[model samples]
Target: MKPIKNVCVVGLGTLGTQIAIQAAAYGYNVDAYDPKPDAFATMQTKVKAAMQMTRKGPTFPMALWDAHAAKVRLHSSLAAALLTADLVVEVVPEDVESKRKVFAELDRLAPIDALLATNSSSIPISRIESVTTRPEKCLNIHFYQPAVGMNMADIMGGSKTSPETLQAARVFVRSLGCVPLMVQKETLGFCFNSIWRAVKRQSLYMWDGGFVDFRDIDRAWMTFTGMTYGPFFLMDLVGLDIIYAIENIYFESSQDPRDAPPASLKQKIARGELGVKAGIGFYKYPDPECTREGFLLGA
Candidate 1:
């Protein structure tokens, strides 16, 4: 309800850190809380690598990113971080209960009028909103990897989300230099994420069914789209463990056997193959095969 000048980000994981950085880049005062001791340090290392590897894309320059990344305040306690927040975004894991716990805590700590949002890629705020008293003030402000040039956000509301809240959120997204993709109706996966989910599902199905090699699939996608990375490569960046969790969410929602995650994927996660963070997933990090010039040509 206020001007949304100060933003509090709970859970400084991958996207959490990026959101904080993007907000700060636009001159918004940002405070974040994460139990992980090295969350801020890890975010710096991860974002620096991402900027270096990404030769193109993302409108902001390196200096801007550096300047803001340095200013994002990371705090040990959620209460301290939420003290002056006009907006509080929960970026915890994808699980519903985890989100509910965070949302309840955020509701208790954040200012009465401060907007509470979830960066959950799939789970709607509706499912998680009731935990807090102000359902009208709670909404889903899902973000893609903004640091990588996917500079757009899905702005979806719960059953009780107010129109004023929605407009303010759109303005907030724009303030961060991102397009607000307002979802007209409630959906499991918001806008581009739903489409991406389909691609991911089919890609995994084909790979798991032994119908085609994953590498060949990536090549096909890269060649067709003329993009730097393909589905598998992008999935690796999204993290294999995260992909598995998202897939399981779909499977649980539909109760469809075909939607279930493959056993091999589980095995990979069990071995700590979490993608770029773990240094090995679909491919090794620091120099994934997909980043090589010869990848498209099958070299």
Candidate 2:
């Protein structure tokens, strides 16, 4: 396995920021890229808030927060970000054309030895690899949001991805103190996400079909699974817009009417009730019921 020192993260959104912060906190030099100047303007503040939130879990050293934050360099261009990267984790928007465009650029500008990975939750690495010359080096490295707390990433490869690349990715993830959940074959949504998609699909169905209240669904889930949050809560945390897009990917993959995202979800998106970011979704946030242990546990 190659010794990874410099990690390049392409995107500055939620998952991207988490990945970038975790990499830096682990002493790796991280270069992050985003097209928006506004995104860059508040990068430090976002990182600080993320770090503070994650610090609750004692995930990263608080004493090193500033130093680690400093290790991350934000770039406006892909070429600049990929310059010295040993591993490139692309967390760009989850669209086929968008991901393909980033891969094409990465394949052209990044070092030949740099391993390429995507933080995509739904799209398979094979689809994205078609745009790159180095299919063997491209793989998926999907991370749960608040990655530092989760400490898990799903590593999968395309049809052409070599065993060597998979192992290298596993080593890289381990180096960051995160567990690597390997996808044995090319599977949509990898491992945990596949299961998560089911829960989300059903939750949306229940809510849209008028079968159950979203809060009740979460209550049953938390009580049965012993998890702090349920599908609706997770969907809100992930943002309804993102959830809709992922559902669309699943729908496109299966073409099953059941896999189709609920129309209510689209309506929510239209109204700007995009979950926690919008301060309203399945539940009101900034103080969602799911966040309260007493509410979740019925205490």
Q: lDDT per residue, candidate 1, 1-299, as tens digits?
A: 57889999898888998899889888899999999968877876876666555444455776676787888898988899999999998998888899999899999989898999999988989999999999999999998988888899999999999998999999999988899999999998988899999999999889888999899999998889887778887887788988998889888899999989998889989999988888888888788887887878899
Clashing pairs in 2: none
lDDT (10s digit) by residue, model 2, range 71-123: 78988787998999889999888898999998999999998989999999898
lDDT of 1 at 289: 81
Top candidate, metric TM-score: 1
In candidate 1, which residue pairs get closer than 3 Å at backbone N, Cα or C atoms, i.e. clash?
A: none
The lDDT, on a scale of 0 to 1, for candidate 2 is: 0.82
Q: What's the CA RMSD of model 1 in angstroms?
A: 1.2
TM-score of each: 0.97, 0.92
Give me the displacement of residue 5 in model 2, in angstroms: 1.3
